[model samples]
Target: MRAAIGVWRWRRNPLRRTTDLVEAWVALVAVALLVLAVPAAGWISGTRTDASLQRAVQAQTRQRPVTTARVVRLAEAPAPGTQSPESAGEQPARRAVVATWSAPDGTTRTGTVATRRELSDPGDTFRLWTDLDGRPVTAPMRPETAHAHATIVGLLTAALAAVFVEAARRLVVRRLTHRRYRRLDRAWAEAGPDWGRTGAGS
Candidate 1:
C-alpha cells in the first residue's frame, strides 16, 4: 500500500519519465550477465587443459594414476618460471604452491607450484618433473573445476529468467504510470466550474 502511494506520488513528477534511464538499466543488467558468464569461459579453458593432461598421464602410466593428488604441502609448478600470478604486475611471483606429492615411481617428494597461474592444490595428482640439476617441480595442468552439465544449463535458464523479469517489471511500471496520469488528467479536466455542473440551460 505504501509502495503504491509512493509510486502514485512519483507518477505526478514528470522528471522520472526518461526512457533513456530505462534503457540504461537494461543495458547494465545485460552487461552484468555478460561478465558473470566469464566463469564459463574459464571452465572451458580448464576443460581443455584437463583433457590434455589426462591423455599425457594415460600414456606414461599403466593405470590412470589418480590425476588429482592432494598436495600434502604447497608444491612448485613442474616448469621453472611457468607459474607467475603477477602477469599484470611488473615482477612475476617467484614461488608457487609449496606442496608434496608421491611420484609414479612411488617416491614421495615436496616441491613448489611456480607456474604463471594458480595450479592444483594439495592431493591433486599431477605429472611431476625434475630439472637438469635434479630440482623437483610440478605444475597443475588438469584441474577438474567444473560442475555437472545440467548446472551450466540451469545457469543459462536463470539468466534468461532474469531478463524476462526485468522486462516485465518495466512493462508493469509503464502501465501503472500511464493509468495514474490518465486519472490525474481526468480530474483536472473536470475541475472547471462548468464541468459536470447541474444542467443550467438544458
Candidate 2:
C-alpha cells in the first residue's frame, strides 16, 4: 500500500527525478512478489516434503514390527549420576531389562532392552519394536510428526523468500540513491564557478 501511494504521489510531481519513479516501481514489484510468490513457494515446498516424509513413515512401519519380550531379570542399572532422563526414572517410563523373544527368523533372541515397566520379578512382559532381524529399533514416524516437520519447512521457506525479495529491493534502491548523489555532485560542480558572478542571473 505504501509503495502504491509513493508511485501515485510521485507520478506527476514536478520535482520528482527519474530515479524516484524507478525506485517507486521497484518497491511496488517487491510488494507484489511478497504477496503472491512467497506463499506459493512455501506451499509447494511443504507439499513435497510431506509426501516424502509420509513415504518414509510407511517404509519404516512395514520394516519394523512390534513383538512381546519376556523379562528374564532386571538389567544392571547405570550409575546414579550417569543415567539420562530417558534411561533413569522410578516411575514406569523406560527401565532396562534382560529379556528374550522370538525373532522373525524363528530363532530365540535375548538382549538388554528398554521397557516402560517396573521390573520386580522374572517373566514380566513388555512390547518391543524390532526389525526383521529381531534387532531393536526406534518407533516409526507418525503422520502427525511428518506434518509438523512439513510445517516448519514451509515456514522457513516463506521467511527466506521474503528476505530475498526485501534484500533485492534494498539493493536496487541503494544503487539509485548513489546515482542521484552523483548527478547532484555534477550539477553543483557545473554551477559553482558562476554562482557569484555579476549579472549571472540578471
Candidate 3:
C-alpha cells in the first residue's frame, strides 16, 4: 500500500522528472525489504539463537549434576563497597563458603562454593551443583530462559535491519537531490550567458 502511494507519480504524471521515477523504484524496493526481508532475517537469527542455546543447555545438563554439600565453614563476606575477585559480575545475594561433597565415583572432594544462605557453623548442609570432578558449578540453563533470550535477539536484529534500510533510502534520496541540483546549476549557467540577448527569450 505504501509503495503504491509512493510510486503514484510513475504511473501517469506528465511533470515527473527522472529523479521521481528512480526514487519511486527505490521506495518500492525499500518497502519490499522492510516488509519481507527484515522479518525473514529476524526469524533466521532467532531460530539459530534458540538452537545454539538448546545445545548449550544439553551440554551443561550432561556435565553438571545436583548434589548436597556440607559447609565446613563460612568464608568472610566481602567488605562493604568492595567485591572479591572471584565474585566479579556475580550477584551479591549469594556468598562464598567452603564445603565438601561426594562425587559420582564416591570420592570426597572439598572446595569453595557460593551459597544463598550465610552459614555460621560447620556441618550446615546446602544444595549445590557440581561437575564430574565434584567441583562446584553454576546451574544448568533453562529452556524458558533460552527462549526469552532468543526473542530479544530476534527483536533487536529486526530493529537494526529496519534502521539500516531507512539509512540507505535517505542516502539514495540525498544523492539524487544533489544530482538534480547540479543539473539545474549547469542549465542556468549555460542559459545565463544568453539572457537579454536578441531572440533569447523566444
Candidate 4:
C-alpha cells in the first residue's frame, strides 16, 4: 500500500525528475523485501530454535530419571523474614533435606533434595530426579515453555530485521538526495553567468 502511494512519481508528470523515478524504484524494492524477506527469516530462525530446544528437552528427559528417595535428615530452616526476594512469593517455602535413593545399578546414593513439606522422619518417601551419575537434578523442560521461548526469539529476530531494512532504505534515499542536489548545483552554475540576458530566462 505504501509502495503504491510512493510510485506515483513514476506516472506521466512533467514536474517529475529522473531522480524521482529512481527513488520510486528503490522504494518498491525495499517494500518488496520488507514484505517477503523479513517473515521468512523469522520463521526459519524460530523453527530451528524450536527444534533444537525440543531435542535438548528430550535428551535431558532420557538422561535424567525419576526415582523415589527417603528423607534421612532435615536441614535447618531459614529464619523468619530471611527469605530471598525470588522465593518470597512461594507458599510454605521449600526446605533442603538429605535423602537416600537406589540408583539404576542397585547402588544407594545420598544427596540433598528440596521439599515443600517439613520432613523430620528418616523414611519419608518423595519423588526426585537424578542424572546418569545418580546426582540430584532439576526437572525436565516442558514443551509449552520451549515453544514460548521460540516464539519470543522469532519476534525479536523479525523486529531486528525490520530495523535494518528501514535503515538501508533511509541510507539509499539520502544518497539519492545528495546526487540530486549536486546535479542541481551544476545546472545552476552553467546558467548563472547568463542570468541577466533576456534570452537566458528561457
Candidate 5:
C-alpha cells in the first residue's frame, strides 16, 4: 500500500513536464499489461494447438483398419474389477477422461469421459479423441498445455520498453540544460560591463 502511494506520488512529479509524466504513465501501463497477458495467451495457444493435434490423430485413426466399432455413452467410472463368483467382493473405480468432438451439424461438444470404464448407458454420447500421431490416446488436456511459465524474456521485453520510454524523456532535460547554459554564457560575457569596470555600463 505504501508503495502504491509512493508510485502515485511519483506519477505527479512537479519536476517533470505534464507530457513527459503522461507518456511515462502510459508506457508503464502498456508494459505491465503485455507482461501479464503473454502467459495467458501462451496457455490458450498451447491448448488450441493440442486440440488440433488430437483432431489430426483421430482423422488418421479413422482411416486405419479397425477390428470392430461400437458406440457407447461416456462414463466417469473405471472398468469394473473382476469379483469371485463364490465370494461377493467387487469394487467400482472412478476415473474420467476429458473428451471433445464435432457433430454432423458442425457443433462441438466436450466433457468428461470415463477411461476403461463400463459401457455407456442409454443416451450417453461417446466420441473418440486421439493424439497427434493418429493413435487412440486419452484425454485432450496435457500436463503442460495449461501450464504458464513466466520467463526472463518476457520480463526483459517489458523492462526494455520502460527503459526506452524513460530514455525518451531525457531529451527534454537535455534541451532545457542547453538553453540554461546559453543564458549563463551570455550573462558571463556581460558581467564585467554591468559592473562598470571599464566604462562598460555607459
Candidate 6:
C-alpha cells in the first residue's frame, strides 16, 4: 500500500529520480507474488505431500493388524529409586512383559513386549500390532497426523517464499541506492571548486 502511494505521489514530481520509480515497481511486483504466487505454491506442495503420506498410511494399515497377546510374566522392574520422572505422571506406565500370541499362520509365538496395562498375572490379555508374519510393529500413521504434517509443510513453503521475495527486493534497492550515491559523488566533485565562489558561474 505504501509502495502504491509512493508511485502515485511521485508520478508528476520533477525531483523524482529513476531509482524511486524502480523501487516502487519492485515493491509492487513483490506484493503481487506474495498475494498470488505464494499461496499457490504452498497449496500445490501441501497437496502433493498429503497425497503421498495418505498412500503410505494406507499401505501400513493394510500390512499391520492388531492381535491379542496373553501375558506369561512381567519382566523385571527397575531397581528402587531408579525410576524416571515420567513414572509419576497420570499416563499409564509401560512395562516389558513376556507374552505369547498366535501368529497369522496359527503358530504360537512368544516374545518380550512392552505394554501399558496394569495386569501382572499370567493369561492377562492385551492388544498388540503385528505385521502379517506376526512380527511386532508400530501402529500405522493416523490420518490426523498426516494432515498436520502437510499443514506445517505448507506454512514453511509460504514463509520461505515471502523471505525470498523480500530478499530480492532489498538486493535490487541496495544496488540502485549505491548507483545513486556514486552519481551524487561525481556531481559534487565536478562542482566543488565553484560551489563556494560567489558569482563564479554567473
Q: Candidate 3, which ten residues in sequence have the lowest lDDT sum?
A: 78-87
- TM-score-better candidate, 5 vs 6: 6
Model 3 clash pairs are: none
Residue range 1-202, candidate 5, lDDT tens digits: 3334444766758775454455445555545544565455555555665566556555645553222113344445532322223222222333344444543334554544443344344343344543333333333333333232223334454566556545655565566667767777898887945774666656
> What's the CA error at residue 106 for candidate 5, in Å?
33
Better of 1 and 2 by lDDT: 2
Per-prediction CA RMSD (Å): 13.2, 3.8, 3.9, 4.4, 14.7, 4.6
For each candidate, what TM-score against the reference? 0.29, 0.86, 0.82, 0.82, 0.31, 0.85
Q: Against the correct fold, how does model 6 do in TM-score?
A: 0.85
Writing each residue's lDDT as its tens digit, candidate 2 over 132-163 gives: 99987766777888889998999899999999
Q: Which candidate's lDDT is highest?
A: 2
Per-residue lDDT over 1-202 for candidate 4, one digit per residue giving the tens place of the 0 to 100 score? 6676767746778888887887888888888888999998888889999999999889978998889989888856532232334344653656767789988677899766676575536678877777788877776777877898898898889889988988998998899999999998999999989978987767
Q: Lowest-lDDT window of 10 residues in candidate 4? A: 78-87
The C-alpha stretches of model 4 lying farther than 4 A from their native spots are 76-92, 117-124
Per-residue lDDT of 99 in model 4: 80
Ranking by TM-score: 2, 6, 3, 4, 5, 1
Q: Give me candidate 5's TM-score against the actual structure.
A: 0.31
lDDT of 3 by residue, 26-144 (tens): 98999999999999989999999999999998998889887888888876654232233434565556666777898867888877777666552588887777778877677787788
lDDT by residue for model 6 over 1-202, one digit each (tens)?
Answer: 8878888877888989999888888988888899999998889889889999999989988898778989999877531232224344623566677889888777889887766667546888887777899987776778888888998898899889889999999999999999999999999999998997989889
Whole-model lDDT per candidate: 0.49, 0.83, 0.81, 0.78, 0.46, 0.81
User: Which parts of model 2 are misplaced by more than 4 Å?
Assistant: 77-93, 117-121
Give me candidate 3's TM-score against the actual structure.
Answer: 0.82
